[model samples]
Each structure stands twice: as structure tokens, then as C-alpha cells.
Target: MKSKKILVWFRNDLRLHDNEMLVEAIAKSDDILPVYIFDPRNFQLTPQYTYRSGVIRAKFLLDSIADLRKSFQRLGGNLLVLTGYPEEILPVLVERYDIAEVYHHREVAHEETKVSADVEDCLWKLRINLRHFIGHTLYNKEDLPFPIKDIPDGFAQFKKKTERDAIVKACFLTPEVIAFVAIEEWGDLPAVEEIVSAEAMIGEVHQELIGGEEEGLKHLNALLEEGSTIYQKSTVKGATGKSGFSSRLSAWLALGCLSPRMVYWLVKDAEETFGTNPHFSQILLGLLWRDYFRFMFKKHGQHFFNDYAMKPERLFSEDREKLLFEEWKNGTTGNEYVDNYMAELNTSGFIPHAARLLLSTYLIYVLKIDWIKGAAYFEEKSIDYAPANNWCNWAIVAGGGKNTGTIKSAFDLDKQFKLLNLVVYKQ
Candidate 1:
């Protein structure tokens, strides 16, 4: 019998450890082709800025793909890099190769969901079976107590239900690496300039962080030992607060270099070792918040894309919307504190979580612009950006995305200034 061939589609789940799809594929097949399609649409989607991706994020993605190639080679497999719509390219691969099935981690957001659907449709037309596994979060989607449609509206409720009544499952072990041809032969990784034009990155900084599974695991281990304990102190202490511990894992998790389930288990282990400490508990709270956003997104679905994920009917003025978006993106709307944080993110593909919430509320509620625009802007620039947390959190502060029907006035920057012990700003 001929060796069965399968294609492992790479997306957010970029690592080999505890990867359900890869394990299943290896169990079922003798040969596997690891494929990563840099869908042009991802870079083409224009968010609040004229360019869809900032240089920092773009550069980071380039580095990440490079890293994946190295890891795949170590594991005895190869990564195929292609630039185009997956729907269009997947079929071509199916015809050219003896593809028995297509395996990948499931995607849930509006855009990714649509892309997966498109890929499924095209593959079905070609008579290729597509297999999707759940591995991103600690809780598997099918195992959730409620269906995606019946998920609750608030994070507190979602967290309570999951915490009290449910469990965060264990991770699956990685499959043995299947040795194959080198990825460079499939297609060379694109240069930063090749992915987007120089004009697209005019004001955007070009410093992207390194990306890959090894880097992701290294980051995860670092957070457990040093990050959780000093999180509050570092953030509160300013410069020292930037402890590489803020788990800088967001970008990796977003890209699938790390799995949320693995993150949860690591945090739990850290707590077992040092949960009694106040600093460690504080760090655990942040991890819980990350899970909270994931739960909220599962419940809300694409409703997250609207101005107010919950209050789609409520509308903002056009002029206010345009001006606010410009100010937030440029980091120069005369609000020095807000500008400071925005400038940090614009220059470095990073911003602390506290700053993220503060600046988002400022842009949406205080500026009275459409929160969707702010979400879009962050999506473009943030290395760790996820649609659910980014968009739903925006709605929460903007006084939307809730079942409570309360649209509180946007956050008061003056109050935030006082809380941060910075010189207070007046209205």
C-alpha cells in the first residue's frame, strides 16, 4: 500500500508539543506535509490605519516563520510556505500531492472562521477530508458546559461557571517528528519588504520580536519562575515592571507558537509551587483574565466586531469617530499620558495590559468614537492581538458587549492618572 499523505495546516497553533492535529495526523499517516499559507487577506485587511499591519508586527511574523522552519527541520518534517488565499492554494496542493486528509486546529473568530469555512468548501469540492482539533485553550470547545450560542454575557459568570463547575484539561503529548524535505524547497520565507510595501509602513516601527515554538516555550518557563512573582511590582514599579514576565506569550499564543491550555497548566503548577505568595496570586489573576477573554469570545462570536458588541444599534457621530481614530493611532491627540502609551506600542509592538484597557476606553468612551475602529487599530499593531479579547474588552469599557444594558460614560483618564500616581490631567 502507498504511504498515506496528509497536510497539517499551520495557523495560530504553531508548536509541536501537545498539538492535537499533528499527533492525530502522525497516528493515522506514514507521511505528512506541514503547510503554512500566508493568506494575503490577513495583511490586506485595512484596520483603522491605511496599512493593515505595522512594521513591528510584520517583522515579528517573518522571524516566527523562520523559527518554525528551524523547529520543523529538527522534528524531521518540512514547512511549506505559500503566499495567496488558502482556498485557492489548498486545492492546487491536493491535486499535485496525494493528500489523504487536511488537519488543523479549529479557528473560531469571524475572519478565521470564514477562512476555515472557505478552505473546507474548496477541499470538499476536491474530495479531500479536513480534520480540525481543539488545542488552543485549556478548555476544549466541545467540552464546554454550554454551547457557543448559549454562553453567558459577562466574564465573571463565564469564569465562575468554568472555575466552579468545569475543569481545565491536560495537554496531549506531541507526536514523533516525521522527517521530510526541507521547507526552503517548498518556498523561501518572504522578506519583510516582500510581504508589504514600504509605503504601508511609513509611520510604523519595524522592530518585530523573534517568533517560534522554542521561543514560546522559553517564554512560558520564564514566566512561571520569575514573571508571576514580580508582575505587579514590575508594572507598578515602571521600568522594572517590564519584567520580560508580562508573559510576552500573547504574541506566541495568538500565533499558535504556544497553547493556552499549556499556559493554564503551567500557571497552575506555579501556583502549586508558590501560589501562597501574594505576587504569584496576582500573576495568576492575569492568566485567569486571559482565559476570561477567550470564554467571552466563544460566547459572543462575531458580535465582537460591532461598535458595541452588545449594543449594535447604538451609533457614534461620524466626525467624532474619524478624529478619535486618527488621534489614537498617531498617539498625538494632546493627551500626553494616553499618547505616551500609544507611542510605546507604535514604536515597539507592545503595551502593558493596563495601558491597553486605559487607552482603549479613552478612544471609545471618552473620545466617543466607534470602539470597532480602536479594536481594528490594535489588531493591526499588537503582536499579541486576539480578536476576542481585543474587541470584547473594547465593548466592555465602551459600555457595550454586556447583557446589563448599562452604557457607563467612557473611562475618566483623570481617574486613571490618579490611580497610576501620574500628574492628573483635566478634561
Candidate 2:
């Protein structure tokens, strides 16, 4: 009998629990090689000249990778951490390890999908299959009521149909033990400075939220035990500038340190234990929104990053536009609420969802700057930035995407501020 060797490529899905790719690889292979590649391209400047990922986000990612490696170690396996392009690096690994196949989670955004395609192409030359698993969303795409092409353009329709028809799948059991191929060097985790620019490193690190599956799971458990009153009040205060008290699970979810299904089931258990909570529903709705954005990206491709609905023209010159953008980015736009929110984002690499809405509204409708630029800045700054959610939400706010109907006049500044119990800012 011949032994099977498989390579498990770790992308955003970085955890041991609820990882279909890891479980599948363990089930099928005699020895598995788990690897994570820190692609330099991800750290390069965006087209809008912002860091593709700022220093704090880069640090959080590194922390997650380190934590994941520790998890594999505890399971009697090792994770190979390398810094290079996956497309170029994976084939060599496949050949060296005598891997019969590679398994990875599929990504939806254009850049991520392109990287997957490139890796697949390279692996094809080696005649080794690269199997893709869908494990990111709370609801699997196959379970959806509608096909990708026919998915509702508006969230309301999508939410209504999917909630009624679809079901959240149970999480994959965490592997207790694993066999890893022999390697002299698993590679050292790089420091945050090595992965980002000095300029990006200027801001305060969001040290309160440490990265890794252990921390993520702990946070989830703690949140559930805290109950609805604390959760609701914290959320309200976060919006009203009292304290940053939202779930803050996004940092973990964005990195795949926390599984959405795991979140759903755990929240369900909490509901069963403590009775129904509206705040719990809000958390689930957030997961649904996350799924919606990813599916929308799959459906629309690069169009999510474009001005799909053709936004009204702005009269400002390029120089004037740059000035306005700088003010907004620096939290000096003279609008007290917007400035405070921007300051929080710039300093901590995070802000509450309400802050995000108000800030987006200010940028798109009030200042009349290009929403793409704002999205680009977020791509650079946000520690929890998921490509689909970030870009698609910006498009929705700009009134230039399939979601326009779902959130009619979503960027109406006065209405948004009032909803948050915030005083409308005067220009």
C-alpha cells in the first residue's frame, strides 16, 4: 500500500477548529504539510497609494499565524511559515514533499481569486490537484436558496429568502492529532516592521485584541456569558463615543481565527441557555451580511470595486479633492463626529460599525470625495478588513452597487447620524 502525502495551504482560514480543508486533508493523507505564505504583494501600496495593509493589521496577521503554528504543534504537527508568493512557492513545496494534492479554502475577492487561479495553474504543471473548500461563511453557498447569478441584489431580499430556506451547517470537528512531513526548518515568523512601512507603523497598535484561535474562542465564550444587556449597552455606547464595546469578533473572523458557523452554534447555545436576545439576532444578522457581501463579490467580481451605478459627478479639482481626502484621513475635516471617528480608526485600526457608516456617509455624500479612495484607505488601515465586506459596503454607501435597493439613501448623512443618536454635523 502506498502512503498519500497532501499539502494544506493556509490563507485567511487560519484555525484548527471548523476547518474543512484541514479535516479533509487529515482524513485522506498519510502525512500532511501545512503552510502559510506571506505574499509581499499584499504589503505593497494600493493603486490609491495607501499601504495595502497597514502595520497594525500586518502585526495582527503575524500573530494569528504564530498562534496557528502553536496549535499545529500541540496537535503533533507543524505549520510551515514562509514569506513569498504562493503561486511560485507552492509548486516547489508540492514537489519536495511528494504531495499528491493541495487543499485550501476558496476566496471571493478579485485579487485573492486571482492568486488562487495562479496557484492552481502552477500546480497543474506539476499534475497535482489543488482542491478548494468553502468554509468562510456561516451558510455554505450550496445551501443558499438561490444560485450565485440569481442571488438577490438587495440584502433584504437575500436575507428574507436565505433565512427562510437555508440552514447553517454544523462545524467540522477539530482534529486531535495530525501527521506532518519532516522538515528541518518550519520558518521564523517575521516582525511587524518587516511586513509594513515605517509610516504605517506610526499609529497606536490595537493591543487589546490579540490574534489567534485560542484568543478568538475565548472572546466568543466571554461575549456569550456577558449576556444581552451588557452587549446592547456596550454597542450603544460604542456608537455614542462612550467606549469601544462592540463584540470586536470581526478581527478574529476576518482572519479565519474564528469560524462563523462556530459563532452561530455557540450563539444558539447561548440563546437556549439564557433565552432569546435581540443582540444575539444582531450578531447572526452580521454573519449573514458577511456572507451576503462575499457572495455579492463572487457574483459581481471586480464590479464591486467599481462605481457600478455611476455616481453623480463631483466638481472639485484633483488638488482640491486630495486636500479634502487628507483632511478626512487625518480626522481634521472640521465635522466633530466624523473627525472623532476617523481619529479612532487611524489610531486603533478599528471603529464600531456605526462609526463606519457615519464616516462613509460623510466621505461620500457630504465631502463628495471618491468612495473608492475611502475604500482604499480602509483596505490600508482596518485590522479587520475583509475585501468583500469593505469594498461592497463602500459601494453600497456610494449608491453605486446592486445593494442600492437594500439601503435606499444609505449615505444620507442626517438620517444616519440621527439613527445613531448622534447630532448631525454642520459643515
Maximum-TM-score candidate: 2
Runs off by more than 4 Å, candidate 1: 45-49, 179-184, 204-208, 227-245, 282-288, 304-324, 404-427
For 1-427, candidate 1 gives per-residue lDDT tens digits of 8778888888877778878898788778877888998877777757455455666777777767878878777776668998999899988987777788999877667788889899999999988988887776767766667877777665567667867767777788865557452234678888877877576577747464577788878867876787454542224222223332354667888777887777777777887876556555544555566665676666666654444343433235777667667777888877765787888788888886667766865665456565667777787788877776676667666556654331232234445545444442222
For model 2 the TM-score comes to 0.93
The candidate maximizing lDDT is: 2
User: lDDT score, residue 70, model 1?
Assistant: 81
- Report the C-alpha lDDT of model 2 over 216-308, residue by residue, as the tens digit: 999889889977656623333424445544687898999999999999999999999888876788788889889999999889887754454
RMSD of 1: 4.1
**What is the C-alpha local distance difference test score of candidate 1?**
0.70
Q: RMSD per prediction, one decimal?
A: 4.1, 2.7
lDDT (C-alpha, whole model) for all candidates:
0.70, 0.84
As a whole number from 0 to 100, the lDDT of residue 258 in candidate 2 is 97
Give the least accurate 10-residue stretch of model 2, judged by summed lDDT: 232-241
